[model samples]
Target: MDGRVPAALVEETGRWTFGVEPLPEAADTAARLRRVAGLVLALERPDPALDELLGALDRAERALSRRVPADPAPRVGPAADGDGRAYVDHSRHIGAFNACFPEYTIDVDGSRATGTVNFPVVYEGPPGLVHGGFLALFFDAAIQHHNCEVGEAGKTAGLELRYRRPTPLLTDLSFELTRTVEGTRIHSAGRLLSGDVVLCDARVDAARGQRSRLPAVSPRRVP
Candidate 1:
């Protein structure tokens, strides 16, 4: 069989991220893959090993992500309350981002803080069960905050999610993020617990960055 299938995919699309899914430009995956292959074949080189080809692509993708780790949008919440928790953003669409859903709070007091969100009946997805996606959100925030606890804030580079058991909507779920420093990469393990039962767990790779540094600002001012 010819390797043209994969080659054609790479040639048509210059890069996977440039022409692929979920981009602001357009959410096209199949078309992008085809384009990528076409670009690869147009090259002057002859047949290269499939493994070698994949390796080159992987390197290029990682380089792209390293340049922009996290969304630069400002998501600052309301003024901090005396207890160190405040209801700043009330999101109705994504249950995870909204503090109104489970009404959870994070205490940024240097070390790790426990985030507990009580899933109500209204948040149910399955038959009297909380949606699995919300759990991922819980872990995401928890692990992210874990890095912030120890004076090291980082963007999520990689995340591995696992669902152990069905989470009951009526119950209250508590999540905690434990941090481990492995080189410059900050590793974290997040757990979703309802009383004694384990609901879900996740392994997150958060990239360390300096909090004091600011992004390059444009010369234009916001007058």
Candidate 2:
């Protein structure tokens, strides 16, 4: 909802706890990275000063890379604690600190939701328009966010989108979503809008399953 969770809703739903709280440090770093990414795309020509920045970034990358080895493990889903309770770290649902993911925020109100997003210049596809694929990705995340907040979420069975018009980049846009639950299936429909004009719309179908039924993550050995 727009405000905090209603007490009655929490009592009826048994306290919806799915996503973990985002660390402030990680959030700050992500905001900085996003700004840097935007500037990288906005540059008109290669500036000699960028070479210095690039060298510094390369050194930082190598320094960080040496500290950890790659592990192919699922970061999302049910992780068991010592007390035998499942805890899911869904911080990445809203992009987390991952620079590759599109960033947006949604507010859930019962079966309906609303949110706003501004596609950065880095996400541009055509001349001054946001990529169609990114719009689809944003809709999927927004709908799933709405479903999870309402206490009913599942794996996406299917997703369909319709591009009514080209969505512009670097402009504030809003969206709305409505969800319906039918037995073990959840249907969510959403639309991206620029003021009153609809630029894109999406429908997502997900198959609901118990958290216990989710497969446990096993890290893969790297050679």
Candidate 3:
């Protein structure tokens, strides 16, 4: 192969978390949640009970919100140090809501990281293929997680992706990131693969600085 890359061993480490299945108890819960999400999206015919189910779920959500109105942003594994909740790392992340969160595992090794995930039937687009937007999301997250490894966490400044082949759903997918540091900026490239096939490629540029707004300083009187 001209530019082919070999697959890395998927290891369980403290640096990895998010949608993991290490703890048997947590894994069981995550599996159930993922299955429920799949059923919610895979159905073609509308079920009469869906409305009632939604109402019940809504009530439960409201009750939970009342109990714990706010929670710290979920972190990824033990490497996470940020205080706020990370929407991307949350157990019930946006992707998880669509049934994609619980299907992946990330491995961090210094300035590099790799992830393996399988998209279910619910993430289908363009026939039996995964949607382009979702692929982008994975790439973005993979690179961001890589940036976290070098203690230079930041927001993505720019991202570019190329679709080499249609990513098939319900198949094992691999994502890899190779990050480089250039002073305050982090450059990363990621690839999505299915076995020997390259499905998508992405490059991301991230700046290391204030990820959020800086606290305002009192104005000093000047003559």
Q: TM-scores, in order shown?
A: 0.49, 0.78, 0.64
Q: How far is candidate 3 from the true structure (C-alpha RMSD, Å)?
A: 12.3
Cα deviation of 177, candidate 2, in Å: 0.4
Clashes within 3 Å, all models in order:
20, 1, 2
lDDT of 1 by residue, 110-134 (tens): 4455677676644567887878776
lDDT of 3: 0.62
Any residue pairs clashing in model 3, and if so which? Answer: 73-84, 73-85
| Cα lDDT tens digits for candidate 2, 80-188 | 2112221223522556555556788787789898888988877889999999998888888778777767766778999999999999998999999999989989999
Give the clash count for model 1. 20
True-vs-predicted CA distance for residue 17, candidate 2, Å: 5.7
Of the candidates shown, which would achieve the greatest lDDT relative to the real structure?
2
Top candidate on TM-score is 2
Worst 10 residues of 1 by lDDT: 13-22
How large is the C-alpha RMSD of every model relative to the true structure?
20.0, 7.3, 12.3
lDDT of 3 by residue, 66-154 (tens): 65315454433331333333323322123433335435677778877788988776666798888888887777766765665444556
lDDT score, candidate 3, position 168 = 90
